[model samples]
Target: MKNIIITGTSRGIGYELAWQFADAGHNVLAISRKTPQTLLGNKNITCLSVDLSDETEMEKVDNFLSHSWKTVDIIIHNAGSLLLKPFSETSQEDFENIYKVNVFGVANLTRACLPYLQKGSHVVTISSMGGIQGSLKFAGLAAYSSSKGAVITLSELLAEEYKEKGVSFNVLALGAVQTEMLQEAFPGYEAPITAKEMADYIFDFALTGNKYYNGKVLQVSSTNP
Candidate 1:
């Protein structure tokens, strides 16, 4: 079984992803701002409290993982922040906070874990379709969209850099899924995909050991018609 680390595991997609990995019999290191509600009885899962907003906490996580695991087979940079405010009205503080978690926080965690990542290990980042297309259809998401765009770029760069090292990077560029984050920004909105379903697909993709998927952004949505 693979030793996997996933961030933002308190709820929604993160929560679902943790459960999926654990059920697959992999050792999971789940990280989040608070202990997750879903990992209550899973022995395969280890939940670590980490506020990605705090760089110090992320550093602690880095150190902990480096000391504990000989190597990580998978690292999922899934914790993210979104500020649903118009660009014109977005406060400076919110912008900074968004970038802090979405951009800088991701970078720090990846850098910290790089040393422990071995050949054939995979790095997955949860990006958004917004990162590819600047669809203003969703109002007040400039900060969020811009940050996701940065992630797309980061994934590309890592794919090229890690190719020779036998590491792979894939960005799951997801469409709207039903999650608390979604409801918070778009109340009563209906989405075609659910978080649990998306999590299942991601787990499957990661295990395929297919190098062709490397450095590519895979978009997912409900296959339900």
Candidate 2:
């Protein structure tokens, strides 16, 4: 079984992804700000409480991985932050906070995990459809969208830089999946896909995507919007 690392596992898509991977017999290093409520006692899962945006907390994660595992097969960057407000009203602090978790956190964690990632390993970072230009732009999500955009670009550059190492990097630009974050972003709107559904797709991709894809930003959406 492969040893996998997934961030933002406390809730939503990240939590579901952790469960699916563990159930499939993979050793999952689940990281989040808090332990997932449903994953309290699973043997295949190890939970690390970490604020990915904080360097100190991420250092602990790096240390754990360094000592615990000889190799990592998949690294899924699912942890993210969102802030919704009109661009004119969005503060510098608000923008930075979003970037800290969504962009910088991914970079920091990936760097920390690089040593353990061997040949044929896959790195998947979750972006958003909102980040794509001309794709259902929402007025209040300027900061969130911009950060996700940065994630896509970063993943592309890493993919190019790491191709010779047999490491594959890709970004999944997801549409609105029903989750707390989506509810917060658009209170009355309903998403077409559920978190578990998205998790299934992601888990499958993470397992076999290196064979057919890399250096790509794929959009996962069920609706035109």
Candidate 3:
């Protein structure tokens, strides 16, 4: 019933959210670097190919938003990157790319869409527990973790700035879910949670965009661990 814009829809949480929302009867704007074959036939879903890391392409994002949707009820920034190399091994290019999407891309997209966001609109970003509290197990996550932390902080600031207008901003600090990204991050590792389950919970949690939940981190994991 809502018009939602979701980024990173090529796979993982973004793809799941796009389908879930479409199944719930909402009109979904699914943006990603490439359109997924699975979502090509959905009438209620519109897929946009976007390179979110390219800040220069923000105008394309705006044009897409303007053409496809008149009003945006939700904006879910689920696009993220992971650099799993030790700080010493991480390259400057990796840092820039991570920040480009994880930080600046979100900022630019939101700014461009704000003009269309109604008073009751919601803006959500996916964060991580690693961003919440750095884990020693996550050896090469400095760039990714800091970018996520930036997301959480940005959500808080957005909530404050838009509080008077009845718009809400929230962050979901997700734990490991069985997704391609997880597999890529920790190859050969097993996870107790699936991306579908995580997406389901996130969709439900979004229904309760109370002021208390706004500007807060909703961390989800298997068995609440």
Candidate 4:
């Protein structure tokens, strides 16, 4: 079974992803701010509670791989921060906070995990449909969507840099999925998909998509929400 690393695993899609991978017999390292209550006893799943924005905390990831596994087959950058405020009222600190978790965190964690990633490894950075150019845009998500957009570009650049090394990098620009983050942002709005459904798609993609794609952004959405 493949050893997989998934970030943002305390809730929503990240939580589902960890369970799905473990249930399918793949080794999973689930990282989040707080460990998932149900995943505590699973042998196939290891939970790490960490602040991804901190370089010091990221060292624990290196330690885990060095002590437990030989290589990481898949790395999914799923952690994100959302700020829904009018552009006029958005502060620079707000932008920094959002970018810290959404963009910089992804970069930092990927860098730390680089040594364990082999030729066939796949790095998937989760993005948003709102981050896609020419897609529908929302006013209050200037910071959130901009950070997501930045990661897509980051993945593309990494893909080109690693092409000869045989590592693949891709971005999934997801549309609205019925996640806790979405419910908190828009209480009554119904999303076209559920977290588990999207997790299934991502689980399969992370396993085999690298064979056919590298540096590609797949926009997974049904509507503009």
Tens digit of lDDT per residue, candidate 1, span 99-186? 9899887888888788888889998898887777644346689889889989989988989998998899888878888889989988
Cα RMSD of all models vs. native, in order, equals 2.3, 1.0, 1.7, 0.9
Off by over 4 Å in 1: 37-40, 134-137, 222-225
Colliding residue pairs in candidate 3: none
Query: For residue 141, what is the lDDT in candidate 1?
Result: 90
Cα lDDT computed for each candidate against the true fold? 0.83, 0.91, 0.84, 0.94
TM-scores, one per candidate: 0.92, 0.97, 0.94, 0.98
lDDT of 2 by residue, 129-215 (tens): 998877898888899998999989999999999999999999899998999888987798888999999999999999998889999
Per-residue lDDT for 163-199 in model 4, tens only? Answer: 8989999999999999999998888999989999999
Candidate 4: regions farther than 4 A off: none
How many Å off is the CA of 37 in candidate 3? 2.2
CA displacement after TM-score superposition, residue 152 of candidate 1 (Å): 0.3
Clashing pairs in 2: none
Residue range 5-102, candidate 3, lDDT tens digits: 89989998889999999998999989888899899899889888888888777788788777877788888898888878889988889899999989
Q: Between candidates 1 and 3, which one is better according to TM-score? A: 3
**lDDT, ranked from best to worst:** 4, 2, 3, 1
Leading candidate by lDDT: 4
User: Could you say which candidate leads in TM-score?
Assistant: 4
